[model samples]
Target: MYGYEITQKVKAETNGNLILKEGALYPVLHKLEAQGWLTVEAERVDGRLRKYYKITEAGDKERVNLLQSLQEYLKTMEQLFQPKWSY
Candidate 1:
Protein backbone atom coordinates (compact mmCIF):
# COMPACT_ATOMS: atom_id res chain seq x y z
CA MET A 1 0.00 0.00 0.00
CA TYR A 2 0.99 3.57 -0.47
CA GLY A 3 1.98 5.63 2.58
CA TYR A 4 -1.39 7.32 3.06
CA GLU A 5 -3.31 4.09 2.62
CA ILE A 6 -1.07 2.40 5.17
CA THR A 7 -1.60 5.22 7.65
CA GLN A 8 -5.36 5.13 7.19
CA LYS A 9 -5.53 1.36 7.48
CA VAL A 10 -3.55 1.38 10.73
CA LYS A 11 -5.78 4.10 12.11
CA ALA A 12 -8.92 2.22 11.17
CA GLU A 13 -7.65 -1.09 12.50
CA THR A 14 -6.68 0.47 15.79
CA ASN A 15 -9.99 2.33 16.14
CA GLY A 16 -8.21 5.66 15.72
CA ASN A 17 -5.94 4.99 18.66
CA LEU A 18 -2.89 4.80 16.45
CA ILE A 19 -1.94 7.31 13.80
CA LEU A 20 1.07 7.18 11.51
CA LYS A 21 2.68 10.33 10.28
CA GLU A 22 4.54 10.72 6.99
CA GLY A 23 7.60 12.17 8.67
CA ALA A 24 8.11 8.96 10.64
CA LEU A 25 6.76 6.51 8.10
CA TYR A 26 8.67 7.34 4.96
CA PRO A 27 12.09 6.94 6.50
CA VAL A 28 11.23 3.43 7.70
CA LEU A 29 9.81 2.57 4.29
CA HIS A 30 12.98 3.71 2.64
CA LYS A 31 15.07 1.78 5.12
CA LEU A 32 13.08 -1.41 4.51
CA GLU A 33 13.40 -0.93 0.78
CA ALA A 34 17.15 -0.54 1.24
CA GLN A 35 17.29 -3.71 3.40
CA GLY A 36 15.55 -5.77 0.68
CA TRP A 37 12.55 -6.29 2.89
CA LEU A 38 10.09 -4.39 0.68
CA THR A 39 9.70 -3.70 -3.00
CA VAL A 40 8.32 -0.47 -4.42
CA GLU A 41 6.28 0.09 -7.55
CA ALA A 42 5.40 3.45 -9.01
CA GLU A 43 2.29 4.19 -11.05
CA ARG A 44 0.30 7.17 -12.13
CA VAL A 45 -3.25 7.68 -11.04
CA ASP A 46 -5.39 10.71 -11.82
CA GLY A 47 -2.32 12.49 -13.17
CA ARG A 48 -0.45 11.87 -9.94
CA LEU A 49 2.37 9.48 -9.32
CA ARG A 50 1.98 7.06 -6.47
CA LYS A 51 4.36 4.53 -5.01
CA TYR A 52 3.11 1.26 -3.59
CA TYR A 53 5.15 -0.99 -1.33
CA LYS A 54 4.88 -4.77 -1.15
CA ILE A 55 6.61 -7.02 1.34
CA THR A 56 9.17 -9.47 0.09
CA GLU A 57 9.45 -13.11 1.20
CA ALA A 58 12.34 -12.26 3.48
CA GLY A 59 10.27 -9.53 5.04
CA ASP A 60 7.57 -12.00 6.04
CA LYS A 61 10.17 -14.11 7.80
CA GLU A 62 11.56 -11.09 9.58
CA ARG A 63 8.07 -10.05 10.59
CA VAL A 64 7.44 -13.38 12.25
CA ASN A 65 10.71 -13.18 14.13
CA LEU A 66 10.01 -9.67 15.30
CA LEU A 67 6.52 -10.62 16.46
CA GLN A 68 7.87 -13.52 18.46
CA SER A 69 10.43 -11.27 20.10
CA LEU A 70 7.76 -8.73 20.94
CA GLN A 71 5.55 -11.42 22.45
CA GLU A 72 8.39 -12.65 24.62
CA TYR A 73 9.19 -9.15 25.75
CA LEU A 74 5.59 -8.46 26.63
CA LYS A 75 5.37 -11.71 28.58
CA THR A 76 8.46 -10.74 30.55
CA MET A 77 6.97 -7.34 31.28
CA GLU A 78 3.75 -8.93 32.44
CA GLN A 79 5.62 -11.21 34.81
CA LEU A 80 7.58 -8.29 36.17
CA PHE A 81 4.38 -6.43 36.98
CA GLN A 82 2.63 -9.32 38.72
CA PRO A 83 2.01 -8.76 42.43
CA LYS A 84 4.02 -10.95 44.73
CA TRP A 85 2.56 -12.31 47.96
CA SER A 86 4.64 -12.83 51.09
CA TYR A 87 3.54 -15.21 53.87
Candidate 2:
Protein backbone atom coordinates (compact mmCIF):
# COMPACT_ATOMS: atom_id res chain seq x y z
CA MET A 1 0.00 0.00 0.00
CA TYR A 2 0.94 3.62 -0.31
CA GLY A 3 2.66 5.37 2.56
CA TYR A 4 -0.38 6.95 4.19
CA GLU A 5 -2.42 3.80 3.71
CA ILE A 6 0.31 1.76 5.30
CA THR A 7 0.42 4.05 8.32
CA GLN A 8 -3.36 4.09 8.61
CA LYS A 9 -3.66 0.32 8.44
CA VAL A 10 -1.03 -0.18 11.11
CA LYS A 11 -2.68 2.35 13.42
CA ALA A 12 -6.11 0.80 12.89
CA GLU A 13 -4.88 -2.71 13.52
CA THR A 14 -3.06 -1.70 16.67
CA ASN A 15 -6.12 0.21 17.95
CA GLY A 16 -4.02 3.28 18.68
CA ASN A 17 -1.63 1.31 20.81
CA LEU A 18 1.31 2.11 18.53
CA ILE A 19 1.52 5.10 16.33
CA LEU A 20 4.29 5.59 13.74
CA LYS A 21 5.19 9.14 13.14
CA GLU A 22 6.58 9.80 9.66
CA GLY A 23 9.83 10.60 11.41
CA ALA A 24 10.09 6.98 12.48
CA LEU A 25 8.29 5.19 9.67
CA TYR A 26 9.92 6.64 6.60
CA PRO A 27 13.48 6.04 7.74
CA VAL A 28 12.73 2.44 8.54
CA LEU A 29 11.06 2.05 5.20
CA HIS A 30 14.07 3.48 3.45
CA LYS A 31 16.45 1.37 5.47
CA LEU A 32 14.52 -1.78 4.71
CA GLU A 33 14.38 -0.83 1.10
CA ALA A 34 18.14 -0.33 1.17
CA GLN A 35 18.71 -3.68 2.84
CA GLY A 36 16.87 -5.54 0.07
CA TRP A 37 14.02 -6.35 2.45
CA LEU A 38 11.46 -4.27 0.59
CA THR A 39 10.82 -3.28 -2.99
CA VAL A 40 9.61 0.27 -3.35
CA GLU A 41 7.67 1.65 -6.26
CA ALA A 42 5.88 4.83 -7.12
CA GLU A 43 2.45 5.09 -8.66
CA ARG A 44 -0.17 7.67 -9.34
CA VAL A 45 -3.05 7.22 -6.96
CA ASP A 46 -6.06 9.54 -6.56
CA GLY A 47 -4.35 12.17 -8.70
CA ARG A 48 -1.19 12.13 -6.62
CA LEU A 49 2.01 10.15 -6.70
CA ARG A 50 2.51 7.68 -3.92
CA LYS A 51 5.21 5.22 -3.01
CA TYR A 52 4.31 1.67 -2.07
CA TYR A 53 6.32 -1.08 -0.48
CA LYS A 54 6.32 -4.81 -1.03
CA ILE A 55 8.21 -7.15 1.23
CA THR A 56 10.90 -9.14 -0.50
CA GLU A 57 11.93 -12.73 0.13
CA ALA A 58 14.67 -11.61 2.46
CA GLY A 59 12.15 -9.68 4.50
CA ASP A 60 10.08 -12.79 5.16
CA LYS A 61 13.09 -14.64 6.52
CA GLU A 62 14.15 -11.66 8.58
CA ARG A 63 10.65 -11.31 10.02
CA VAL A 64 10.59 -14.92 11.11
CA ASN A 65 14.00 -14.62 12.74
CA LEU A 66 13.01 -11.44 14.53
CA LEU A 67 9.75 -12.92 15.82
CA GLN A 68 11.52 -15.99 17.11
CA SER A 69 14.06 -13.88 18.93
CA LEU A 70 11.34 -11.70 20.42
CA GLN A 71 9.41 -14.74 21.65
CA GLU A 72 12.51 -16.11 23.32
CA TYR A 73 13.13 -12.79 25.03
CA LEU A 74 9.56 -12.65 26.29
CA LYS A 75 9.78 -16.19 27.62
CA THR A 76 12.91 -15.31 29.55
CA MET A 77 11.23 -12.25 31.01
CA GLU A 78 8.19 -14.31 32.04
CA GLN A 79 10.40 -16.86 33.79
CA LEU A 80 12.28 -14.15 35.61
CA PHE A 81 9.02 -12.56 36.80
CA GLN A 82 7.33 -15.79 37.83
CA PRO A 83 6.87 -16.53 41.54
CA LYS A 84 9.90 -18.39 42.84
CA TRP A 85 8.06 -20.16 45.66
CA SER A 86 4.78 -20.30 47.54
CA TYR A 87 3.77 -16.83 48.65
Candidate 3:
Protein backbone atom coordinates (compact mmCIF):
# COMPACT_ATOMS: atom_id res chain seq x y z
CA MET A 1 0.00 0.00 0.00
CA TYR A 2 1.20 3.47 -0.80
CA GLY A 3 1.75 6.01 1.94
CA TYR A 4 -0.94 8.34 0.65
CA GLU A 5 -3.36 5.47 0.21
CA ILE A 6 -2.77 4.35 3.79
CA THR A 7 -3.33 7.89 4.92
CA GLN A 8 -6.65 7.90 3.12
CA LYS A 9 -7.64 4.65 4.75
CA VAL A 10 -6.69 5.84 8.22
CA LYS A 11 -8.61 9.06 7.68
CA ALA A 12 -11.71 7.35 6.36
CA GLU A 13 -11.89 4.87 9.21
CA THR A 14 -11.08 7.40 11.92
CA ASN A 15 -13.79 9.42 13.62
CA GLY A 16 -14.33 12.95 12.24
CA ASN A 17 -12.47 11.81 9.10
CA LEU A 18 -9.32 13.38 10.45
CA ILE A 19 -6.14 12.64 8.56
CA LEU A 20 -2.94 12.08 10.48
CA LYS A 21 -0.63 15.01 10.30
CA GLU A 22 3.07 14.64 9.58
CA GLY A 23 3.96 15.07 13.23
CA ALA A 24 2.48 11.66 14.04
CA LEU A 25 2.38 9.86 10.73
CA TYR A 26 5.95 10.50 9.62
CA PRO A 27 7.53 9.24 12.82
CA VAL A 28 5.64 5.96 12.67
CA LEU A 29 6.51 5.51 9.02
CA HIS A 30 10.17 6.29 9.65
CA LYS A 31 10.22 3.90 12.58
CA LEU A 32 8.69 1.14 10.50
CA GLU A 33 11.19 1.79 7.74
CA ALA A 34 14.04 1.75 10.20
CA GLN A 35 12.77 -1.47 11.72
CA GLY A 36 12.67 -3.17 8.28
CA TRP A 37 8.93 -3.74 8.62
CA LEU A 38 8.25 -1.46 5.66
CA THR A 39 9.93 -0.69 2.38
CA VAL A 40 9.66 2.49 0.40
CA GLU A 41 9.92 3.21 -3.28
CA ALA A 42 10.27 6.43 -5.17
CA GLU A 43 8.05 7.04 -8.16
CA ARG A 44 7.32 9.86 -10.50
CA VAL A 45 3.62 10.60 -10.54
CA ASP A 46 2.28 13.55 -12.49
CA GLY A 47 5.90 14.51 -12.98
CA ARG A 48 6.40 14.77 -9.25
CA LEU A 49 8.41 12.45 -7.02
CA ARG A 50 6.40 10.44 -4.54
CA LYS A 51 7.29 7.87 -1.96
CA TYR A 52 5.25 4.69 -1.66
CA TYR A 53 5.32 2.34 1.31
CA LYS A 54 5.05 -1.41 1.04
CA ILE A 55 4.63 -3.91 3.83
CA THR A 56 7.52 -6.29 4.35
CA GLU A 57 7.58 -9.82 5.77
CA ALA A 58 7.95 -8.52 9.29
CA GLY A 59 4.96 -6.31 8.75
CA ASP A 60 2.82 -9.30 7.74
CA LYS A 61 3.66 -10.96 11.01
CA GLU A 62 2.82 -7.76 12.81
CA ARG A 63 -0.56 -7.51 11.07
CA VAL A 64 -1.47 -10.96 12.25
CA ASN A 65 -0.36 -10.21 15.77
CA LEU A 66 -2.43 -7.04 15.86
CA LEU A 67 -5.50 -8.82 14.51
CA GLN A 68 -5.24 -11.60 17.04
CA SER A 69 -4.81 -9.12 19.87
CA LEU A 70 -7.87 -7.21 18.79
CA GLN A 71 -9.90 -10.38 18.54
CA GLU A 72 -8.94 -11.35 22.08
CA TYR A 73 -9.83 -7.89 23.30
CA LEU A 74 -13.26 -8.12 21.73
CA LYS A 75 -13.79 -11.53 23.24
CA THR A 76 -12.95 -10.19 26.67
CA MET A 77 -15.46 -7.39 26.24
CA GLU A 78 -18.14 -9.83 25.10
CA GLN A 79 -17.60 -12.07 28.12
CA LEU A 80 -17.89 -9.10 30.42
CA PHE A 81 -21.12 -7.96 28.80
CA GLN A 82 -22.79 -11.35 28.47
CA PRO A 83 -26.09 -11.73 30.29
CA LYS A 84 -25.95 -13.35 33.73
CA TRP A 85 -28.39 -16.27 33.98
CA SER A 86 -28.17 -16.90 37.74
CA TYR A 87 -31.56 -17.21 39.48
Best by lDDT: 1
- Which candidate leads the pack in TM-score? 1
lDDT of 1 at 73: 95
TM-score of each: 0.91, 0.88, 0.70
Which parts of model 1 have CA positions greater than 4 angstroms off? 83-87
What overall lDDT goes with each candidate model?
0.95, 0.89, 0.85
| Candidate 2 error regions (>4 Å) | 83-87
Per residue, candidate 3 scores C-alpha lDDT tens digits across 1-87 of 666777778888886478777577888999989999899999899999889988999998998999999999988987999866685
| Model 1 lDDT tens row, 40-79 | 9999988999999999999989999999999999889879
Distance (Å) between predicted and true CA of 85, model 1? Answer: 17
Q: What is the TM-score (0 to 1) of candidate 1?
A: 0.91
Q: What does candidate 2's lDDT look like per residue over 32-81, in tens digits? A: 99999999888887898888899999999999999999999988988999
Clashes of each: 0, 0, 0
**Candidate 1, which ten residues in sequence have the lowest lDDT sum?**
78-87
C-alpha positional error of residue 46 in candidate 2 after TM-score superposition, expressed in Å: 2.1
Q: Quote the positional error of residue 50 for candidate 2 in Å.
A: 1.1
